[model samples]
Target chain A: MRFPLFLSALFLLLLPLTAGAQTKSINQFYRKYKHSEEVFNITVPGWLIKLGAGIAKSQAETPEERAAFQMVKKFKKLKFMVMEDHNLVTPRDYNRLISGVQSESFEELLSVRSDGARINFYIRDKQETIKNMLILVHEADSFIMVSAKTKLKLEEIADLVNQALDGDLDNEEIVPVIKPQA
Target chain B: MKTFKILLALLFVAVGFTAQAQDDAISKYFNKYLDDDRFTVVYISPKMFQLFDKMDLNLDDEEAEAIMSVVKDMRSLRILVSEETPKQFFDEAKKAFNTNSYEVLMTVRDKGGDNVEFFIKDDGGTVINELLLLVGGEDEFVLMSFVGNIDLNNISKLTEAFEGDGDDANDD
Candidate 1:
């Protein structure tokens, strides 16, 4: 009787941990695809974001530049992965990656279908505020996923995009994802 | 007793699976793309809007505060423009949206374009869940969606700041 009771208790204890493990995490995708030549991974640490913000701050002499950097300062940890090789990262692979990335906790923020690319944006919210934002850009030739750890507002990003278009930001490395509309 | 415990564990897993079955329809289009390179896409999340609330817009203190307050409700914004987008694609997009039962907020016929339709998914008449703007033109098309508790009045105010009396709109 005691053996059965103890076994049941152990199962109960392990259940939560196993449930947590099953949830798809971004780290898992990074680990799985990092080895493949098709996947190009870029991890920007908090320090790098801070450094980028600092450089942007120094470059801001004009009002437009200052306005643009204001948005850049909020970015913390950013991870970007792009599937470059079409043969390896086919539509099936893209769908699989998307399914793995989409979790119950993250809410759908935006999804757009453009000429060459289809972009999906998701966010994890805490206390009515966004804790993290995930962006999936699937193009004809490639699939790109950008995970940004931030509390910055959504419209501020649009403002930043608008500001970026104003010809203030010269730092290409930090702002690789912002594709201007023609 | 061991068997009973295993059965309970399996039940828990089944429940978890059932809970995650709800999928948003918009996600389906997030992987579709046309071969032509005549499309433009823009996505902005609510977090960025929250960041905007924190910024000093260099306007009058009252005006800035009011704008920020209106902006707080916006969650996300997505814009897609395509020059080579086909009519069938636009029709299919509209049909998908219709299936989701999004209510039309307004429709306008522009001299330059065929028609512009604005659709809104309202939440309890207090907040808007999603707002969709689809502009079908003769040559080009524009599709924009804003997800959140959006106030249309405030949106018009925000547009005025950028468009600035529509003086340069015709320059394009």
Candidate 2:
């Protein structure tokens, strides 16, 4: 009787932890296709990202470069997956993947479809800080998914976009500066 | 134990019904075309708007301030657009939404057979809850819904801000 009682107590204790660690649907989708020959996947750790950010900050010569450095520093991890073959992901599967992502507490930030290409941005946030961001780009012949884990405040991103729109930050100038050095 | 199980089952049923009822009409219309490849959908949640309200944007410019004031009260924005069979889609959208609850704010028809209409939902006061915009032309259809406590005065100020920026650009 005491053993049964202890087992019940143990189950109660571990239940919440297991639930908390449950894999998100987006991650599950990534794992399913990441190893396929048609898919290209890359995962960068937080430490490497920080190291690169520090290096870029040191080399920053322009205001655009400085702004890019500040934005890049907020990212903790990044996962990129791309597939060029249209035969790999069926339309039904794509729809299911989208539904699954939405069910996982991810909210749509923006979506655009034009000239046979569709781009979607989704973010998961807690209060005023964004926790995770996912970008999905689907074209006639290719699909790309980019996921980032960050603790960025929402205002920072808005301010950056505002600056970019106001012609204060030139995106072309920022791109080369943030590129990782060999 | 049997009675407890019955009660749990009933509770689940009640919760399911409540969830179904809570889905708004605009969401239902959006979901209808979500899986269709021809349509593009955009959604911004209330949480995002709440976050925007919390943001301390240090812009001292009047234009930026005006835009921020209008943005802070917005709860959600949903947009659906399609280029395939746009006229048909536009007509279907008109039929799908019950317009009796909304007041027609503006309607513009250009010489090119393009139609643009604006509708607002309010509680007989200056505060608006939802603003719906529909555009249908020969090649494109667009339906946009902005939901929140919207002030017409603030929106007019935003337009003025845009006009001011345009004038500045022209001067430069």
Candidate 3:
């Protein structure tokens, strides 16, 4: 009986440590993807994609409309809309993706837990420079940020993002992602 | 036969004159406020108006005229964009996008007049993303996009509604 009781006590003690350690692990994992080479067209949540696709289809029929319709079709087919719950996106990140980098594609896999969420925000910059990027956030006990850049090669872009995420930011509070001033 | 032809020509001329008059009235109000450099808070001239007309963002006759007028009155706007190619701007947006998606930057759209927008290309380019403006009374005067399905005809009607019934809009 004492053995079982002692085991239960130990398990409770270890649980908090695991939770704390998991948060750090998530940050580390996201940092790896930040430096990743492939452009990620991060879109998840089917509702948003459906709305975007409906609008795209309407414009595609208009001859005067620019290539915007075709671009939406391409995004619809990509992995931008895969949600895994842990990956939470921030508004600032969304603005960055649309207004900032002009890239071929962007995607994110969302994963969420009680602590926060994690997103594998990815982009594919097929051009000469790494042009596409996704800003990602994991908000829970702390807010984790992922600044992503993409290249032709997914592996190469992922590496670059990983290097960027390697900076030693003290995980104290949620820092507001500072977007480029308009 | 010659009399009939002359009468038809006169009717056509009358129509043309009436159309011109209507256009002139709206323009008169637009010009009145645009040059004030108070409501819009800027100082603009007719020369700059020609270039702003080319940007794809649709504006009705009144919205365009009103925006031009407001631009003329703005006091707190200056162009901060680097004159560069599309490629360079894309690259800059990308770097900023990766870090913060809504990174605000200015793009030089025309040689004269400040033509800028708040944009982010995130939706895989599905929709033309933009919030075109400067910081002043005239800042939100022009919405630099038509993607929201905003109708120019409706905009004109709305403009007249807000600014008071333009004679043409008042018609049955």
Write the residue-wise lDDT of candidate 1 on B37-79 in tens digits.
Answer: 5667676766567656545453333344456656677776666
Candidate 2: clashing pairs of residues = none
TM-score of each: 0.49, 0.75, 0.21
lDDT values, one for every candidate: 0.66, 0.79, 0.37
Best by lDDT, which number? Answer: 2
Predicted structure with the largest TM-score when compared to the true one: 2
CA-based DockQ, model 3 = 0.01
Query: What's chain A's TM-score in each predicted model?
Result: 0.62, 0.73, 0.23
Q: What CAPRI grade goes to candidate 1?
A: incorrect
Worst 10 residues of 2 chain A by lDDT: A168-177
Clashes per candidate (backbone, < 3 Å): 14, 0, 70
Ranking of all candidate structures by their DockQ, best first? 2, 1, 3
- Candidate 3, chain B, TM-score (2 decimals): 0.26
* Candidate 1: segments with Cα more than 4 A from true spot: A1-24, A37-87, A107-109, A120-136, A142-182, B1-70, B75-113, B118-132, B152-172
Q: State the lDDT at B38 in candidate 1.
A: 67
